[model samples]
Every structure is written in C-alpha cells, then in structure tokens.
Target: MKSRDFTKTGPVAMVAHACVLVVVVCLLGAAVSHAATDEADSPLTVYVAVGVLDVDEISSADQRFTINYFAQFRWVDSRLAHDGPGTIRRDITDITAPRFLILNQQKVWSSLLNVVDITPEGEAVFRQRLWGDFSQPLRLHDFPFDKHTFELPMVSFGGLEQQVIMAPDPQRSSLIADNLSVADWRILGYQTEVREIPLTNDVSVQGFVFSFEAERIFTHYVVKYIIPLFLIVMMSWVVFWIDPTEAGSQLSVAVTATLTLIAYHIALAGKLPDIPYLTRMDLFLFCSTLLVFVALVEVVLTSRLARSDRVELARQYDFYSRMVFPAAYLAAAAWALL
Candidate 1:
C-alpha cells in the first residue's frame, strides 16, 4: 500500500487520539487495582500467648494430662477501628479474628465464651479459656529419674497460609509455677514458640507451641519401691547365713522372700504404662530379682553338701557367699544407674 500522509489535522485524527488516551488510562487503573488487592491479600500477623492456669492431672498410663489454660491473641486491623478513643469489649463471634485448635487435644471438659477487646486504633486483644486433656508422648527410659518436656501445639484452623501467621508474645506468655499441681513432678521452666507446620502434602499452617520442662521428684519411688525392694532382696540373702543342716527352714524363708518380691512387681505394674522397652528402673529391679534367685540356688547347694557329710565345706561356701553376694549386688546396681 502507498503511504497517504496529507498532514491532515481533522475529526478522524482527534477521535483516534482520544481512544488511545482512554486505553492508557484504563491500563493504569487496572495496575493500581491489582496492587491494592495484593496488599489486602497479605497475611495478618497475630501475636499468640498461652498462660497455664493450672495443671490438674497427669496420667502416665493414658499418656495424657488435664490442664486449664487461656490463650491470648493480639493483632491490628484498620477495618475494626471505631470512633471512640478508648477500648471497648465485644463478643469474639462479632469480630473477624484467627481461629485455632489444639493439635493434640484428646478431650474437652469445658470452655468459656471468647471475648475481644478493640481499641479505637484497630488494635484487638482476644482471650479464650479451655479446660481439657492434651496428649503428650512420654519417654521413661530413666523412669523415676526421668525428665520430660510437655508441649501443647496450636494450629490455625480453617485458614490458609496466605491468610494468617503467628508470632510469640513473650510479654503475655507464662506458666504459673504455683498452680502446677502435678504430683511428684517439679517444674523446671517453660517457653513459647512460633512456627509453620505441614498439615498435608500440599498444605501447611501457622503453629504456636507452649512447652514446659519437668523432672520426676523420685523421693516417692525411693521410699515406696526401691528401699522396700532392697529389703526384700536382703531378706533372701539371710538363707546363706543360716545353718545349712536346717534345710527345711532355709527353704521356707527363701520361698517367702521370693513371693514377696513377686507381689511387689504386681503392685508396680499398676503405676506405669505397659511399654515394650526396659528402663533404668526396670534394669535395677531385674538385677535384684536375679540376685535373690541366685541366693536361693546357693541355699540348695549348701544343704546338699551338708547332707553329704561335708558340713565344713558347706560352711566355707556360706562364708564366701556372704561377701560375694553383697559385692555383686552393689556392682549391678551401679551399672544400672550409670
């Protein structure tokens, strides 16, 4: 086609110029609208704090504990701002806030209605109280001397990763040492953490954790289990000191001590969870039982020697056992502890 440029400044040129201006204005508006939408879609940062009010019960058999606690959330949203300059209260249902659930909660006994405090500047504080059982995995390889770190994990429910995020509120998170009434446990310390945890193959959520460290008191086991076990095992050793010629009486005493130890084991079974692996305490108990059985075996041997008319030899065996039994037991006990 030939170029037809007559330098024409007419109605057609003006109309073409107007259409171009409209197209440029429309493109600029779409860009501005897209930027605003992105700003609105960004996740809101919520500060999370957990305050443990009381520790009601800890069940080793069930691997769970009952707790009364309150969780606090604070965030700023300009949409919630009001005309009043002071703070005002509102029901949580009426306001927009993040919802969460305890990831390991087993049962809930009760929960108080949630409340939110809103400031004129759009800062909001939300508090909710819960009483329930939370599951905790326990490792008892040390048993009476074992220390544990218990955790309660909270994750955002029904919210996407681009919708919410969590931050630790150190100023508000706390553990009430005096209110922790778990029997035979001493509270060491506590802390809070903010993290992101994967929920599924293609999804993840914001997580908050409130954790506390505790150690078993151990005095109860020392008095009620270990000391008594030591005495029962010591009773079995008495057979070695008795006159070997009196085999009947020696057998009776040894049998009685063995029966008592068996009963003790039955009583302890009720207090601990049925686990597959052995613990330090279990090792000590096994050694004690073995020593008692060995003592019983010695009594039989000495009695056989006396019956064979070798009374002097029987007495010599008894003398050696008196020293050897105690030394062996002490070594085994040390090994279990170390």
Candidate 2:
C-alpha cells in the first residue's frame, strides 16, 4: 500500500526539502550581512559643552553637591540619507539613538530644559540646562588642603563602546573655570577623556569623562576652625601658671578649659559625621583636646604633690611644663604641616 504512492510522494518530499534548505541559507546569509554592516558603521562622535551656572550646596559628610549647569550634545549621523534643498531642523523626537550624558553616581536631575537643532550635513544638536545633585568621592584625609577632579560622564542611550564615542567641544564649556560659581574652590581648569567603563566581563560601554580640576580654599577653615582652637589651647595654658597651693583655682581653670575644648570639638564635628578615620581637621582638634586634657591632669598631679608637702618638686614640674607643653604643641603642628 505504501509503495503504490511512492512516485507522487518522492518529488513532493524533495521539493519540500529544497525549500527548507533555501530558506535556511537565505537566513544565514542575511545574518552575516547584518553583522558586517554593523561592523562597517562608523562610530558616532558626540561633542559636549557644559556651562557652570550655580552651586546650590556642598556636603562633605554626604560626599555630594548640587549644581546648575548648561549642557550641549552635537553629533553627525552619516547613516541617515535625506535630500532636501536646505537643512531640516527638528526636535530631538525626530532623531534616533539620542546620545546624552548621565551622571556616574547617584543623582537627582530635574527641571531640564532642552533645544534641538539639525544641520544640512546631518549634524544634530541637543542642548539642555539642568540642576543636578551628584555624588562625588571625597579625600577628606587632607580635608581643606584637598584637591578634587569632579568628573561628569556622557554616554549614548543605545550605542555600545564600539558604536559611539565622545569628545569635549573645547570652544564651548572648556572655559568653565572662568564662570564657576563656588567661592570655596579655586578652579584649576578642565579636561576630557574617552573611557570604557565595564558593566560586566563581556560588556563595556564607551563614555566621555569631563573633569573639572579644583582645589579647596583653606582660608575659611583656618580662620573659622584652626585659629579659634589654637586660642583655646593657649587658654588652657593659663591654668598651668596658676599657684599650685590654690587647688580650687587651678582645678577650676583646668576643668573650665577642658570643657571649652570639648564644646568646640562637638560644635565643629556637628557639621561632619564621626568618620572612622581622622582628617586633617580631626588631627588639629585632637592635638588641642589632648593639650587641654593633659593640662587638667597636670593640675591634679601637682595639686596632690603640693598637698603631700612636696612643694619644691611641684614648682619644678610646673616650670618644666611651661617650656615643654608649648614646644611639644608647636612640634606637633609642624609635623602635621610637613
């Protein structure tokens, strides 16, 4: 029964197999062609411009700051083939694969106002003015003496590292140092670099890094924190000169100075978190606090000696401390500076 229909079935089966092979071959060829086209496509270059508008706030404790800036992105799409008598300018919605910069750290970017413009040579521009609260890494070990390179990176929305690249428009926001709004920092200049940040072992994205070089102005810290703390240290020294026979007055002065040092430290530390490591300011506060505590301890020891009728030894101890304490404090301060 099966042999009787072999003649009709043989040609039909061969034709069906032929069609399947042709379809598979066509699909494989199309895939190879698509990959080759992607490899041949030139990388889109995006030029970025940034303008420093204002600084809203800076928090060392949080390692973040909020600033207002104007940003622009310009690029050319050689792939789009359109023939017009002149340039056809349109909003960004008409463009595909809008490459924009995003903050590398946690940020809040809102209230952005943007404009789009296109040129006859396939050049497209997207400019935005926005305020962003951006996280930055802090090197507080140097505190007021620290220098920072604040980096902002721009990346494409849908392009890979091989598909897009970024460069700074030196003619535009390169002079951001001239118009920066923060007084506590002196702008050193700006620089841009191309970077491929790894998202995974097999995937990395291309990005443009914008660095604003700057250093903190230490005048405010010295005037507000250091000098006052130094005065308090000197104030504690006054207790050392008090008569050892008068235990009440010496103890009162020493205790009062120690309390004042504690108060100053508490107030100063209120602005920053109690980090596990010591900063330059912390080192200064530590020196001052130690001086005051040692002075108070000396008062107790000398007062006790005087009570034990060792008046000569107590006077000698006080005289030596007069020379030793200031020298030691000065030495510590110099060491810190060096």
Best lDDT among the predictions, by candidate number: 1
Point out the worst 10-residue segment of candidate 1 by lDDT: 156-165
Off by over 4 Å in 2: 1-40, 79-94, 105-115, 159-162, 170-173, 177-179, 198-204
Question: Which regions of candidate 1 deviate over 4 angstroms?
Answer: 1-36, 82-96, 159-161, 170-173, 198-205
- Per-candidate TM equals 0.84, 0.80
lDDT of 1 by residue, 1-338 (tens): 97867466688887998899999999999999887677468878788888888888877778887889888888887768999868998887676666778888988864766778999998989877888899988998888788888888887655333477778875675555475778878888888887766668998767888898878888999899888888988888888789999999889988888888888888888777999998878898899889988888888999999999998999999899989998998899888866
Instruction: Please give, for residues 43-62, the per-residue lDDT of candidate 2 as tens digits.
Output: 76778877666766666777
lDDT comparing candidate 1 with the true structure: 0.83
Clashing pairs in model 2, backbone N/Cα/C closer than 3 A: none
TM-score, predicted candidate 1 vs. hidden true structure: 0.84
Cα lDDT, model 2, residue 316: 84
